[model samples]
Structures are given as structure tokens and as C-alpha cells.
Target: MDRVPQVEFNPMAGLRPAGASFTVFAELREQYDWFRSTVGQGFWVLTRYERILEALNDPERFSSSAITVLDPEPAYRWIPEMLDPPEHTAWRRLLRPHFTPASAAAMEERIREHCRELVDGLAGKGGCDFVADFATRFPTVVFLEMMGLPTERLATFLEWEDTILHRPYEPGRATGRRKALAAVVGCFRELIADRRAEPRDDLVSAALAWRMDGEPVAEDDLLSLCLLLFLAGLDTVTAQLAYMFWHLAGHPADRDRLASDPAAVPTAVEEFLRAHAITVTGRKVTRDGEFHGCPMKAGDMVLLPLNSATRDPAAFPEPERVDLGRHPNRHLAFGAGPHRCLGAHLARLELRIAVEEWHRRIPAYEPDPDRPALEHAAQVLGLDTLPLRWPA
Candidate 1:
């Protein structure tokens, strides 16, 4: 750890309540630039903009197979997301048509209506838990629509998702994860069978009919494909939304500006994303290499917190500031390289509509005094409760 500054670099440290990530990011960059951490069985950490991009921009050097420092038990690779190059390319190509920009755009009016309904429930009420009221429900229901899952069973899907992503992986919760994953796999297996027997106008049915390299997908591969889609489509959006509202509740000026001009939301959303970036996914070193003067060995985990790229002073002036209209914004919030997020288009549309609709209904809101917003950070940074108040 040559010239490395004294900083708390624990992976679990950032996974707790309150916001201290940017502080650590700033401190580390100013001192050591980049270094190694003991967390996740000793990972090589990169935080600077250019250094992070250097790895992401070149997949041949850094492998996406183990896309997280946290290694899942039984060595499960999550389809295209955790696969590299040729294998990833084929699966993604088969699934790409289902999530194109046009597909996301087609669902805009429907998403807007859902946003209005969510706001209508909270409108004129003195306050409500923003996370429970809107953030989680809107995305969950939309995911249900896309998957053709039963809307009335939203609680079941939400429960499975929460347990898998949020409850943690201690010995006590090991059974919890098993139960949830088993339940999900069981349900989706039935859904896939139904789709093959009788096609429907949904992602599952569409994927069933798709071929790659001139062959139908294997059953195990199909299950893995749907599993990743279920987790990806439902989880990240809610966390990002919770963080966005947390930002809006704190910054009255930014909130006011967005509320005043709906057109400014797209750019504002980008800035919000940059400032509040949260995922801490990882990649493995493919071979012996040196990045920014840091040495690494084959099979070493390289932690890439895409959000930290926002704090890179070299890439952004006043890197901490949230400029709603910052142009040429090259934030890696959706990520970089070939294995980037497949649902970016859908995610952007949801955020824009959610922000626009929420502000139109309740423009002036802040953190509730009696019950402050609670922060819960982990592999995914989010808040379990975001209580917001407006004029009664």
C-alpha cells in the first residue's frame, strides 16, 4: 500500500446507513490514486476516472465472468451478464430486441399512467414513505407487466427480491436466500413451460422462440437467462429511484429547477445519477498486468464502483457538485464496455417520468423531522425508508 492514504476501504463499511462513500473516494484518490483492499478476499481497487475506464474499456484484460467481488456459492455464472465476449455476445444479441429503445419508448404512456396513479395515492397527504409508496411499487408492477407475472401477486415477487438482494448472506439468512431463489426458479420454470406450450406476447415467450448460432437455447441456459432478467429488471431501478428522491429531498434548489421545467429532467436525471452512483460490482484480472502502477495477478478480483467514476477529479471539475445540465456527461452509471446494462433505455424512461410526475404532484417536499430517512447501503446502495413531507 505504497503512498496509500489512511482510509476506511472496507466493502462492508460502505454498505451501511448514512452517506460516507464520496468522502472515502475523494480521500483515496488524493493520496494513493488506487490500491488494494482486504474486503471480498482481498480485491484490487480502482477509483480514478481514467484508471477505471482503462479496465472497463478493455474487456480482454479484465474479465466480467466474476462481475462482483462477492463470489456466489456453487460458482454460478449469470448468463450473458457474467459471461464474456463470444458467449455474452450471442445471448445478448438474442435478448437485445426485447429491450431496445423503441421497446422502452412504447411503454412510456403506460409508465406515465402508473406514475400518476402512484402519485395520486400520495397527493395531498401530509407525507408518506416514498420508498414503500412509490419507488418500489412502480418498478415492481412494471416488471410484473413485462414478465406477465400476476399483478395481484406483487407482494410475493417483492418478498423474493428483497430477501435475495437486501437481507444479506449470513448463515441465518442462508435458508432465506435458498427459499426465495427456489420459489422464483419454480415459478419461472412453470412460466417457461407455459410459454413453450402456448406463446404469449411477453419476454419469456419471445425468448423461448429465439435462436443463437442456429440453435434453440438450452433449458438450463434459458432458466439462467430469465433469472438474470428477473433480478436486473426489478432491483436496480428502485435503488436508484430511492437515491434520486433522497437527493431531491436534500437539494431544494435542484428540486425546484426540475419542477419548474419538465424538459430539464433528462439532463437533471443524468446529473442525479452521476452524483448518487451506488453499485459496487466487480471484474477479475485475466492475466498478470499493471494498471496505474498497481500490480495484479491472474484471477484477482478488481472492484469497480462505477459511481466512484463521478468523483474522479481528473474527469470532472468540482467533481462533487451535481450539475443538472452538465453536458457531454460520460457517467458510467449504466456501466461501460460490451456487458453494459441491457435495461438502460427502460430505466431512463422510468426515472424521467417518475421525477416529472412526482414533482408535478408534490413539488415541495423534504425529509420528515420525526422520522428521518433511513439509509441502508450494501452491494446495492439504497434506503429502506424515505419519508418525505409537503405542506399539509
Candidate 2:
């Protein structure tokens, strides 16, 4: 009888990849019927593609509130996302209007203007760190503008968000993290006060006037909502842009094809998103349930590898290849069902514009071999520094 090779389960292994598409996730999914991990006596992992889809869709059985990864305290909590059922529905209704396609389209001119300015600034430089100069700044500026925040305070906002999401587990990082989070909370408090004093068309102002169950959205709820939007909108979108650019630069053929025909960007963006799903989501099972025929007990936390699902052979044919013209690409990058990303349309728009404009101006871009490629250090995945060389 043939024996299977001994393999150790290492969660940190997922984080060690210098580039996108870590294979360990797919390997674990294929080998283990259901991967399990124990942290402090009661943590579990659910890695199969099918199990993940079931958990993500069945929010009733797997409540997000039970699994508190960020800001677990009640005093400083967010609305909608953390809430389930009737309450979640109420908050979502108030928030949906701000993210409509027509509303996102209204901001296109502004988003394009920002993209042009960012690219133009790097046009003459022989090379630039794409993350710091372009990817990070682009989405940060757009999100701030959308919230009607002052551009001058962009750095402050970035610091606050990074501390909150990126350093959730490090005790040594707590001091600076707390200070930054305080600054964010303070900033939003003032913004809310001002918006309440004088309402405007911006999201923050719109949220200020929004009411639920015949009562105005409480101050804490408003701040949490704003903070969540800032973090969610900026982090994932920024990481995605960095990963897409990294892939395009490495795969020159795809970049060249995209450059020649800008119209290919929308389709290409979908494929890039599908191919590079680097984040994983967690859910706590409310009741005993069967996942891929494995019994899942109540209170079990399931880690759904979105990256694995996008590459599932059953879902996408030739799952490894990047087909620019991949049609009917239904990826879970933005997630699915009720928890689907509210910012999907806007994120797509931002990516399409970034790819189209960058390719048009730079035309021929490549990674600088001399510089060290930067890796991301958040629950979200992306490059911290992407050094690229192109003609001035």
C-alpha cells in the first residue's frame, strides 16, 4: 500500500508567500476533507470551497456577531455588518442608497480626475513604488472625498485605519494602535457634529440624517459605520489594485494586450479579482450542521478561503490561467448574497479606470529587479511596495 507523505499544518505558511496565490490553501482543501486548527483550546478551520459557500450564504446559522475579530467592545461598535437579521436589515436599508450604481457613476468624473493626477505625478519618474505613490493613495483619496473628508488629513486617516485592522493581534503594537484609533474616533466625532450642524450630500452627512425605527442613527453607530466604510473601502480595494498591477507587470503579455485595447480592462479586472482572492473570511456556526459531510458543532469558527473557491476547478475552467476575455466570471471576491460588498460597483469602476489610465500613460512597465518587493501585513493581502520601471 502507498503511504501519503507527512505534511504539517501551518496557518502562518499562508502569510509567507512573497507573491499572490499561495498554494497551501488549495493543497489543504484537496487533501483534508475539512481542515481543523485549535488556538487557545477552541478554534477551528473550515477550508473546503463548498463548505465556505454554504457558510457565507447561510448567515442565519452562522452569525457574524458571535465572531468578533475587531473592536470587540460594545461601546465602540459598528452597525449593519456586526448586526444580524431585523437590525442588520434596518441599517442596510439606510446605507444602500449611498452605494447605488447611479450614485457611483456620478463620482466617475471625480475618480477619473484623481486617477489622472496620480498617474501624471509618476509619469516622468523612471520608477516609483506603486503601493505608496499610486495604489494606496488613489483609493484613500477617493474614499475620503466620498466621505467629504479634507485631503490634507489623508495621512491621519490612513494611520488610524492601519492600526485598527493590521495590528489587531499584536500586544506590543497596542499603544500606537490605540492612539491612532482614538484619533480616528475623535476625527469622526467632530465630522459628525459638524454634519449634524450642517447636512451635506456626502455619505457621512447622509448617514447623519438617516433614521432607524423612528430614531436617528446613534453617535456611536454613525462613527462605527464611518470607520467600517473607511477601512473596508480603502484596504481591500487598495490591496486588489496592488496585486493586479503586480500580476500584470510580471506577466508582460497580459499587460501589453491590455495596453493595446483599454476596453479589455473591465473583463480583465474581473479575472484579476477572481484569480487573486487573497483574503479569508470567518464565521461562527450557531447550530450543529453538516459541511461537506463533516459534522460541525455549534460555536465552531469556519475559515472560508475565498482564494481557494475562485480557483476551484469546478467553478472556473483552467482555473490557473488568466483569461482576459473570461466571460460570465462569477467570483466570490466581493462575496455573495446578503453580505455581498456594497462597494462592488465602485470598486470595479476604480480598478477599471486605474488599469486603463495607467496602461495608457505608462504603456511599458516592469518590476524593478534591483529593489526588494514589498509584501502586505494585514488580514487583507497585497504588496507593501511594488517597484516598477517605465519610460519617463
- Give me the candidate number with maximum lDDT: 1
- TM-score, one value per model: 0.94, 0.91
| lDDT by residue (tens digit), candidate 2, 247-330 | 888899999999999888888999999988856666667788666665667876656667778887777898778898998898
Global lDDT for candidate 1? Answer: 0.80
Colliding residue pairs in candidate 1:
15-377
Instruction: Indicate the residue-level lDDT of 7 in model 2.
Output: 37
* Local accuracy of candidate 1 as per-residue lDDT tens digits, 112-186: 999899898888787889888889899878988898777898878888987777765453437888888888889
TM-score of 1: 0.94
* Per-model CA lDDT versus the true structure: 0.80, 0.75
The RMSD of every model to the true structure, in order and in angstroms, is 2.2, 3.3
lDDT of 2 at 361: 89
